[model samples]
Structures are given as structure tokens and as C-alpha cells.
Target: MIYYFSGTGNSLHVARQFADRLCEQLSPIVNPVLTHDKSIGLVFPVYSWGIPSVVDNFIRRFFQSAEVRSETPPAYVYALMTCGDDVGYADRVLDNALLSASGRKFDAVFSVQMPNTYVCLPGFDVDSDELCKAKLNRVQARVSEIAELVAARRKDVRRLKRGIFPFAKTYVVRPLFNRFLVTDKYFHVDASKCVSCGRCRKSCPVGNILLIPTTGGQGAEVKEVPKWMSHCSGCLACYHSCPHHAINFGNMTAAKGQYSIMKQLHG
Candidate 1:
């Protein structure tokens, strides 16, 4: 089985491609319950030079569950991360996290460079259409190579060489990001532009978005507005998937472009 956690369809696209090539079932990591015995593949995007908090929690829970411990571990475990650039020591971090959680490690690790979707901060912006298309083409070729390796059950560890800066970034900055940066307090929806579409609520993997009727008096027709809860994963699904571009993370994302690999390729 291939389990994936995606915010803007980059990892999901990779997961689907892998599933097709391997003839495996594709499962979302949302509230996953692992009961059957089979080789496992995890696909997700890198966040803040580390795994997304949602994926981290899911991995920890899945490995520590009694259902997984009651039987032999998966015959082979592999991980594929999608990133705008390099995954700085994320492969080691994942291996270590798995080993610490369940005394098991990924047999193989890989990464694919996709269009950058993390534009909620300064110094970051979505790639231009031409560049994004080029990157997608490259990702397709890389995924094909990854599928070949996975089919052969290759046990190679593909990680970027780490130095002092990379180590500090991954170990120090990553923890800070998980602790302080993953929240929905800064998200806002423009009332004028919002169409009361529940796409944001549905796109949130953590159910952090709530659609509540706008408060008013005197024959004011009911209209829903999205309110973000505190338990956001900072995956940017609601921001990127908003059909009307009504959602914004503070002032950073208002003018930024939104990207979804599936939409870019198919629509």
C-alpha cells in the first residue's frame, strides 16, 4: 500500500504515479488504520526542511499501534518526499523517527523536486508557469526512475549530503517550525471575495476549518464563512485549493500564486 499526505497535489501526484506503476493501493494518511500485512510506501512533501507534522504524527502512531506490533513489520518500507529544492537531512530524520518509534527504518528513501507551493512566507513565491511546467516534466522522469527502483525493492538510501548548516537547519529550525509555525491563527478569509464555498473546510486534512453562518439581524440571508481552528497542520491545502482565492495567510499569500499539480496537468 502507498500512503500519502499532500497539501497541493504534489505528493499525491507522485503517490498516484507510484501506485499505478507498482499496482498498489493508494491510501490517504488521514486517520489511517493499518491492519493488514504488506510492504508500505510513504509519500509526502517536505515542510521546513522536515516532514510535515501530520505525517510525523501518523508515522509515530502507525508504528506504535498494537495492530502493527502484533505481527511482523512490513517486508519493505520506502519513503518518497516531494520538495521544491533538497530535503535537508529529512531522510535521516525520518529513518531516526521510525527507528525510535518502532525499531524499524525505511529500506529506501527518495525525493523529487516539484513546483514550490510554500508561498505563505517572505522570500518565497510560486514558480512561473513555464518553470512549473518544466519542473513537472522533470518530476515525471524522476518518478519513473523511482518506480523502477521500488519495483526491484532497492534498499538504497538517497539523501542529500549534510553539513553543519544543513544539520542545524533540520534539527533546530524544524523543531521550531513544528512548535511555533504550524497554526491557523493567521489565516483569514476575505468576506467580499468568499463565495461561501466549503472547499476550504473540505480541503483541510485536520478539520481545522469551520464554516459558520455570518452573524446578522433583520432578514440577513445566511452565509457561511470559514473560521480556522488552532490545530492546523500548516499544509496550506485550504489556501491553495480555494477556488476563489479568498483565503489568505496574513498578508503574504494574497498576491502569491496557487499551485496544484493535478490541476496544472489535467485542468
Candidate 2:
């Protein structure tokens, strides 16, 4: 069984392809089903140089709530983490979480580079069309290789991209990033540009968006606009999926680019 968490469709796309190659069932990390399957896999994006809060919470709940099948847990547990660049010890963080929850660490872990979609901060933006295409092209082979390794049930295997200052990036900066930046309070919509299309609400994976009604003027027609609840997974799907580029994370995203898996495949 493979469980996944995705936003902007990158991890989901990878998870679907990985599952197909291995002939394994795929499920969301949220609302995870209890499984007696021998091999359990996790596919998700590495956010803020670590696992996203949503993924972390899912690990806590899903592993802690389930009863162990035996003295040892699943025979082989693996993880495939997608990222814009490097994962910076995110695999270690995940292993730590799994160890705490189930007293077992990942047997195999891998990270693959994907198109950049983390554009909510300065010095971070979406990749160029050429780079995006390159990353997407490279990912297929990497995922296939990972799937093959997982199928073989490789143990003690760790293939990660831990960039400069890995310790500082994961331990110090990640906590700060998740604490401050991984939030929905910074999100808002440009009502004029929104057009009340409900695209943002539909794209949100966590159902954190609501379409609220508002009037244009006195006695004017009321239209529903996107409003964000505070339960965001920090995936930026709403921002990247908007056709009109109407969504913004505070004022930081106005000049940033948007990219999604569907856009790469079809756009």
C-alpha cells in the first residue's frame, strides 16, 4: 500500500505513476486505512526542507491509532519525497516521526526534484518553462528507479539531496519556516481578478477554502469569492491553480510564477 499527500499535483502525480508501476494501491495520507499489507510506502513533498505539518500530523495519527500486526511492523516501509531542489534531511525527520509513532524507521527513502512551485517568499519562485520541463522529464526515470527499489524491498537505503548546511536547514530553519510561513492567515484574494470562478476552492486539497458571498455595491448583485480557512497545508495549490492568478499569499506572490502538473502536461 502507498499513501500520499500532494498539493499542486506533483506528489500525487508521482504517487499515481509509482503505484501503477508497482501495481500497488494508493491512498491519501489523510484518512489512511488500516493495512496489513507487507510493504507500506509514503509519497509526499518536502516542504520547508522538512515534512509538511499535515504529513507530520497524519504520521502521528495513522501510526499511533493502528494496532501493530506483529512484534515487528510492516516488512518494508519506504518513502518517496518530491522537492523543488534538495530535501535537506527531511528523510531523517520522517524517519524520526515513524520511529516515535511505530518504533520503526523507513527501510528505504528517496527524494526526486520536481518543478518549483514554492513562490510565497522572496528568493523563491517557480522554475522557467525549460527548467520545469527538464525536471518533469527527469522525474519519470527517478521514480521508476525508486519503485523498482521499493519492489525489491531495499533496506537501509537512503538517497536524499541534503544541500548546503543540511543540519541548520532542517533543524533550525525548518522549524522557523513551518512556525511562521506555513499558515493560511497570509492568504487573500484579489476580488476584482477572482471572477468568483470557485477554482481556488476546488483546487485546495484540505478543503481550506470557502466561497463567501459579497455585494459589488449597494443593491448590486452578490457574488461568491474565495475565503481561506486557517487549515491550509501550505501546498499553494490555490495560488498555482488559479486561471486568472487571482490568489495571493499576502503581497509576496504578486510577481511570482505559477506551475502545476496539469499545466505541464496540457498547457
Candidate 3:
């Protein structure tokens, strides 16, 4: 089984592609507690130098709730992550989470580059169209190459920007972003552009939104209001799929680039 936690479409897209190619069953991370099917592989994006709370909780509850079965094969754990910049810190976060889960063991871990979406920094710029296209092409090629290795069950170490930098990312960079940037002003919803549509709520892999009934100009009305679950995976599907462009990442995230909801390329 392939379990994926994605915020936008990048990780989900990659997870779907890998599962399709491998002929494996794909499961969304929203249902954290599922019956144990040892044929498991995990794919997600790194956020805040840690596994998104969504993925962390899923692993915790899923493994704990699972019932061992004869048909259930031994879990051969594989992890794939997509990142905006250096990847070392995220790997450490993942390693710690897996260790916390007790029984799960990682056979391999891989990383891939997606556009750096953390635009909350003081001076951030989205890639130019030409540069973006070039990077996309590179990602495509890298994903394909990594897929072949997964299909063949190769065991190789894969990382980016060495190890030390990524280690500092979560501790230094990510913490600052989370404290003053992400939580403060990054995730926002634009009411003016919204048409009272609840599409974002439905598309959310984690069911984070809560639709509420309110009296509007037309009288009694029901609207999808975002009441974010703290366990957000940072997929950004809510931001992208907003038909009215109602979702905003606030001041801190206004200039941040869009993140790919795809998975990583394992070595």
C-alpha cells in the first residue's frame, strides 16, 4: 500500500504516479487509523523542518490501530519527500518520526526539489517563467529516474545540500518561519473573491475545513468556512483550488511561490 500526505497537488501527483506505475494501492493520509496492511510506503512534503503534523499523526495512529494479519506482509518502509530548498533537516525529522513509531523501519529515503514556496521571507521572488519551466523539466526527469529505482527496489542514500544545512533548517529557519511568518500571516482566505463555494473543503486531503451556516443577503445560507486543523501538511491545494482566489497566505506568504503537491525522487 502507498500512503501519501499532500498539501497542494505536488506530493499527491507524485504519489499517484508512483502507485500507478507500481500497481500498488494508494491511500490518502486523512484516515489516520486504517487496518494494518504491511505493504506500506509513505510519501509527503516536508514542512517546518519536520514531517507535517498530518503525516506524523497518521503514522502514530495507523500503526497503533492496525491489526496484524497473515495476509499482511512485513512493512518495507520507503519515504519520498519534496522540498523547496535543502533537504537535510527534513530527513532528520522523518527519521525521528519513524523511530518514534517503534516497529516501522525505513528501507530507503529520497528527496526532490520543488519550487521554494516559503515566500514569507523579507525578499522573496517567484522564479521567472523560463526558470520555472526549466526546473519543472529537471524535476520530471529526476522523478522518472527515481521511480525506476523504486521499481527495482534499490537501496541508496539520497540527500541535498549535504547534511548539516538541512539539519539547521528545521531548527533555525523553519522555526522562525512558523512563528512569525506561517502562523502569523501566511494562510489566509479572501472573502471578497469567494462565491460561497466549498470546493477547498472537499479537496482537502485532511478534512481541515468546517462548513458553517450563516445568514447572508439571500437569507439563510451555508458556506464553507475554513477552520484549519492544526495537522496541515502544507499541500496548498486549498490555496490553488479556490475558485474565487479567496484564499490568501496573508502578509508573510503573499510572495511565497506555490509548492508542488508531489513526492520525492529516492536514490
Candidate 4:
């Protein structure tokens, strides 16, 4: 089985491609409750040079559970991370997390470069059409190579080159990102642009967004607005999936454009 966590369809696109090539089933990491024993593969996007908090929590909980502890580890295990540039020591972090939880390590780990989706931050923006297409083509070729190796059950461990900067970025910067940067408090919908469409709430993987009716004057027609809960994963799904570009993360995301792999592929 291939378990995946995707915010704006990058990782999900990769996971589906892998699943098709390997003849495997695809499972979402959201609220994962595994009971069967089979070869396992994980596909997720890199967040802050590390795994997403939701993926980390899910791995910890799933592996440490009584159900998993009662059985032997899978025969083969692999992980593939999608990132805009590179995943600095993310593989190491994921291996350590798995070892800490289930006392097992991934047999293979790899990365694929995808268009950057973390647009709320300054100096980051969605790729242009030419760049995005180039990236998609390159990643598709890379995924094919990876799928062949995985189908053969071969071991391929790709790690970041040993360096102080990469180490500090992954170990020190990642923790700070998870602790301070991952929150839903700043997310709000533009009332004028919003169409009462539930796309934001539907796209959120963790169900952190709610459509609440506005308290207008008496006999006024009510419209629902998105209210973000406290349990956001900072995945940017609600922001990128909005049809009218209605969702905003403070002032930063309003000017930045939206992107989704599915939309790009279909369009």
C-alpha cells in the first residue's frame, strides 16, 4: 500500500502515479488506521525542510499503536518526499521518527522536485507555466526511475550531503517552524470575493475549516463564511484550492497566486 499526505495535490499526484506503476493501492494519511501487513510506501511533501506535523503525528501514532506492535514489520518500506528545491536531512528525520516509534527504519528514501506551494512566506511564489511544466516533466521521469527500483524491491537511500548548514536547518529550523509557524489563527476569507462555496472547507485535509452562517440583520439572506479552527496543519490546501482566490493568510497570500497540480494537469 502507498500512504500519502498532500496539501495541494503535488504529493497526491506523485502517489497516484507511483500507485499506477506499482499496481498498489493508495491511502490517505489523514486519520490512518492500519491493520494489515503489507509492503508500505509513504509519499508526502516537505514542509520547512522536514516532514509535515500531521504526517509526523500520524506516523508516530500508527506505528506505536497496539495493532502495529503485535505484528512484524512490512517486508519492504520506502518513502518519497516532494519539494520545491531539496529536502535537507528530511529523510534522516523521518527515519529517526519511525525508529523511535516502531523500531524500524525505511529501506529506501527518495525525493522529487515539484513546484513550490508554500507561498505565504515572502520571496516565494508559484512557478510560471514554463517552469512548472519543466518541473513536472522532470519529476515524471524521476518517478518512473523510482518506480522501477521500488518494483524490484531494491534499496536506494539518498541522503543530504553532510554539512553544518543543512544539519542546522533541518534540526534547529524545523522544530521552530513546527512550534511557531504552524497555526490557523491568521487565515480568513475575503467576504467580498467569497461565494459561499465550501471548497475551502472541503479541501482542508484535517477538517479545520468550517462554513458558518453570517449573523446578518433580521430577514436578511444568510451566507456561510469559512471559519478556521485551531487544528490547522499549515498545508495551504484551503488557500490554494479556493476558486475565487478568496482565502488569505494574513496579507502575504492575498497577492500571491494559487496553484494546484490537478488543475494544472487538467487544464
Top TM-score hit: 2
lDDT of each: 0.83, 0.87, 0.63, 0.84
lDDT of 4 by residue, 1-267 (tens): 888999888899899988998888888899664746567889999988889888888778877887666665455778989988778888888988899998888888888888889887789889987777888888778889898888888865663323356778798988988887799988888776788989999999889988998845777667898999899989999999899998888888878978988767767
> Model 2 over residues 141-245: C-alpha lDDT tens digits?
998888888888889999888889888999999999988998999888777677888888888889999999987688777788888888989999999988989
CA RMSD, predictions in order: 2.3, 1.4, 5.1, 2.3
Q: List the residue pairs that clash in candidate 4.
A: none
Candidate 1: segments with Cα more than 4 A from true spot = 70-74, 159-164, 215-221
Per-residue lDDT of model 3, residues 115-170, tens digit only: 55444456654455555555556766676776777777765455444346655767
- What TM-score, to 2 decimals, does candidate 3 have? 0.76
Q: Native-vs-model 3 lDDT?
A: 0.63
Off by over 4 Å in 3: 32-39, 64-73, 124-126, 159-164, 175-188, 213-234, 254-267
Pairs clashing within candidate 1: none
Ten-residue stretch with the least lDDT total in model 3: 258-267
- When 1 and 2 are scored with lDDT, the better candidate is 2
